[model samples]
Target chain A: MTQRKYTKEKKVGEGTYAVVYLGKTEKSRQIAIKEIKTGLFKDGLDMSAIREVKYLQELRHENVIELIDVFSNDGNLNLVLEFLPADLEVLIKDQSIIFKPGDIKSWLLMTLRGIHHCHRNFIIHRDLKPNNLLISPDGYLKIADFGLARSLGNANEDLSSNVVTRWYRSPELLFGAKHYDTAVDIWSIGIIFAELMLRTPYLPGQDDINQLDVTFRALGTPTEANWPNVTALPLYNAINVYAPPSRQELRNRFSAATEKALDLLIAMTVLDPSKRCNSTQALMDDFFTESPPPTRPENLPSKNTNKKQKTE
Target chain B: MEKTSSLSISRPYYSPKELSYLHSKTIADSKKVIYNQRKHQVYQYLFQIIKVLKLPLKVLNTSMIYYQKFYLFNIFEEEFEDFSNIEKSMELDPFNVSLASLFLACKNEDCIKKLRDILLVANKIKDNQIEENFIELQRKIILGLEFKLLQILQFNFNNQISFSTDSLVLQFCKKINLNYKYSLFCWLVNFDLMLTPIGLTLPPHCIALAIIIISLNFKPNDLKTRELSSGVNENILDSLNPKDFKCPEKLVNEGILYILDFYIHQYNLSILNNYLPQINEDLNKEQIFKFMNLKSKFNNLRTLNEHSIDGNLLKQDESLSLFDYSISSKGTSRFINKRKRLLEEID
Candidate 1:
């Protein structure tokens, strides 16, 4: 049942495993055709492709990118994904685009909602950076690229701690804890939240060791008292100790954020994995309901409008 | 606009009658016996491969399911007919198809192993002299079949509901407070059922619940194991409800009758047969007789209504047709998991 349902108009991007093409369906609906390069290596199909297909096929949420369809052509696997032209990272990087307090709140709410859906299904989006949180044409934020995502299986199963980008990596993952949970994704979202406020990466460590120092120096070193058995982690070692940030220091750090926002951020970025607030708790936090309501999706600042105005 | 004839929506499941109809079309009468014989041998071969790889039981369970599921849509020995070269055909042998299934299963279950490493272990198990050229050809064939296996699955990676049947069986046993011996008995039944088409017919949860009910009723007092002291909990069986496990009564009944049928017919070849004694002392008969008795008792149970499924519907099911691998290469074959979405698209 192979028909020309979609037409690949142009190549948009290329990764190690797939070449993404900007395409359109027969109904003129925009789609991204991810043509996976099969049989390239001795492994045949890539693990990331399998993970993407396995998890994305099961998940269906407004805040998550839709896997429109999956088909193959000329021995190459093509994943038809909903085309998302913009992402949170691009918006955060554009210095001219001033982010309103409501805009930041809206993006955070959408991100949390998407993640809550995944966590409810027992899936952990291991790579939940701003880059993967794509924006649709109508300004909806979607969680995309589930290359490192996996479902929470048996309790005794060991997970690889060497996941999530170094800057957004959680404390448990940084210290090499294999028995972590969805708390790791919460930590990444917390960092992304901080980046939205600062308009830059919250933690810009050069390497793994620097990442640990940068993370602890910003939030305070995790000790046996705060995070029990943290010292027992595989990568835990002697490091420079630092005091936890006081309320005044945090307030000064994120001057524009409300008290509730700071409280939610602190809850999400807890040093201990068990103590970290999950997606549901984070969504239920008073920050979302307090003060100015989040900006409507259509009214949210977009890069496309700015580009068009500059061209005119 | 061009007609989207190549968009094949994924229908991951079918009724028992539908499955039989598919098999009748795919497997010729002359090749049916040979197909079953090879399937059994391949099951053992995959078990060994999984054992050597140190993969979990879910991986083996999923691989066997994929191996069986592949033959339902594709011809049993069509690969040999396509490949002209004898060496190339050898690469696409039944063992290689099983390897490809195991390979995809490992990835799907998230217990991944390198294809080369798996091939190495498989070669060692088969005692094939792994020449460099032969290994390359085998790798190519396995890789090719891996893609075909994905299409056979219709890109529906989530085959089982939440977990595979073996783990679900153990989980259900623990939930029902069954003793270790009884739980082991259920697990062994699951192991035996993995080799049958019960997985294709019923969901994992239903099959798991059915196994628990069977174990409780079977009362395997003479089950061979190190921890045989813990006797069966007869009260738990009375308290057991299918709703507690999220399994419909009809589906669980179907699973029960199907499992009883499998054991009645193929008890001697089953793994459970090895552990139990030749004669059941309580009933003063063989284990097959116990299964037969269970079958007689459960004969009145309600199962899935296949009567509503007309013969023409089964005959016209495009999903059950022999999957044309070249269709995707020619155009687009869209895979959607939900039947509702397919209907919406049709409208």
Candidate 2:
């Protein structure tokens, strides 16, 4: 707000459109200040930004970052966002801890709920990864960075397959499918789930081509045998048509997860959108319904998801 | 048509201030500053007003959300003043001022207080007087925005589609002690959409998912074989709030929270200066409305789609045509259920 003074603190980060800064309001509210630099991207602000602003503004759950204020001066748009203590990816890389299943469930539950709400509102969180998921010191998982969410209900006339970050990308998206529903999100959730369980990415393909190889090798590539209409996809013709991967390989890769967790994991990451569990169904699975149920936040063993395989 | 609207190639994205300013005067002049203090104050006032309104918290919450979503497209409509909508030849853009839309939502949905009573409280709405034609002007606004609301939200489309799946949804609601239509429909729209993802627009699979999960939660005994049906598997039962349909509690809260969030952003101060015109005239009117909204008025959407509804509607048609006909379609009933429920959010 104009009346409230904003004192820029330190340079936090930078992006395509804006320079990120840490600023404090006159009322002592610490905020993440993003100064939108003009004339950089010929396209100016994208609808993704509007969606982020609107969603952050409307979303007031505890696990969500609160939008403080919006300021425009000298043609620069200043977005004041609630300061999160730290991002999960940062914590995962920086902190050395092994998170138990219970802790994993808490983060997963909170993250899915936040994402599920967005989908219901016809909004898709195009980009979801450990970095975008902010964790408070209290162990609450608040989804931040809506810079890529597109309201699903909006008639985005032209179909574009451009969505999600590479590692977390869904097979349908990778196979060049547009008009994909909320299932793309479920796929991301699957990857996030994998990260939580294995302490590293299950499928880490380098490029789009390598990504497919890693995906099929882990989960196996789709064929007329398993995933019907696989060839109909735009990119289906481009990729090598290989037999499905053995389920035993998947079992071996994710060696530590309980059977119930594996059942839910396989269900969500299924190649078929129809077969894949949407966010709602994923929440109800047996993994979440285990004997002791998912672990409470306080009972979490650790937060690191990048574990190095130990040599015998 | 007003000159405020322009065709949208791509409007500048989130500066936060892109729509923060709200002037005490014209909407165009006042909405200049992105994050001006006055703009923030207006939103604060709106939040306060909605908070104070003694209506069903759910209904108020969703109605405010509808109002907020209406703003998201205002920029689009404002850009294309001439856009024609099939749903309403009136206009496809939302007006800067909602005193009228709010009045209609309250009149039809909330009906909490009389026009005079609401007007007395909302006096600061625009610093104008109660003209004799104010009621009639409000009528035009009711028509204009209502048409836009129907088009943008495509509540009519929702109503049409629900004719098929809602019965399946209703069956599930009955198992959970939410037998009443109010509760059933709320379960269908608010709670169901969140509690049950996967666009029901797809196929029986979406409905199948809902049934299997609801069956598991509602009457796990009835499911012939429920090892793991897509998303709702054995582990899901752990998170279940057994005491009043755990799914309902989680989803209802989600729906209410979303509506609450809608209000916080819907009352944009940017609207204070750049007032979107309330109505549209033909000839030079843009092609925005094009076919959808306008066609709905004259042509027969008839509630049939990829799936044949002849037999389905024929069965329910003769019995409840009286109730269903007054409204656009069964899907309208569903949306009215949602809008009515969400509007009650303030309570």
TM-score of each: 0.94, 0.48
Residue B111 displacement in candidate 1 (angstroms): 1.5
Runs in model 2 deviating more than 4 A are A1-6, A25-27, A46-48, A153-156, A298-312, B1-347
lDDT of 2 by residue, B1-347 (tens): 32221111111111112222211112344343432333244334444444556533233323443454344444322334334543332233233234433443443231334444544445445455767576444445444454444333422222212113334355444454332422332332332232111121223223323343433333212122323322334555354342333233333233233322322333132231122222223323322232123333324322212244343543453211111121322112111113333335335
**DockQ, all candidates in order:** 0.58, 0.01
Q: What is the lDDT for B9 in model 1?
A: 67
DockQ metric, candidate 2: 0.01
Root-mean-square deviation per candidate: 3.2, 21.5
lDDT of 1 by residue, B304-332 (tens): 88887887987787777888776676655
What is candidate 2's local distance difference test score? Answer: 0.50
TM-score, prediction 1: 0.94
Task: Report every candidate's CA lDDT.
Answer: 0.85, 0.50
Model 1, runs deviating above 4 Å = A1-4, A305-312, B1-5, B78-84, B228-233, B309-312
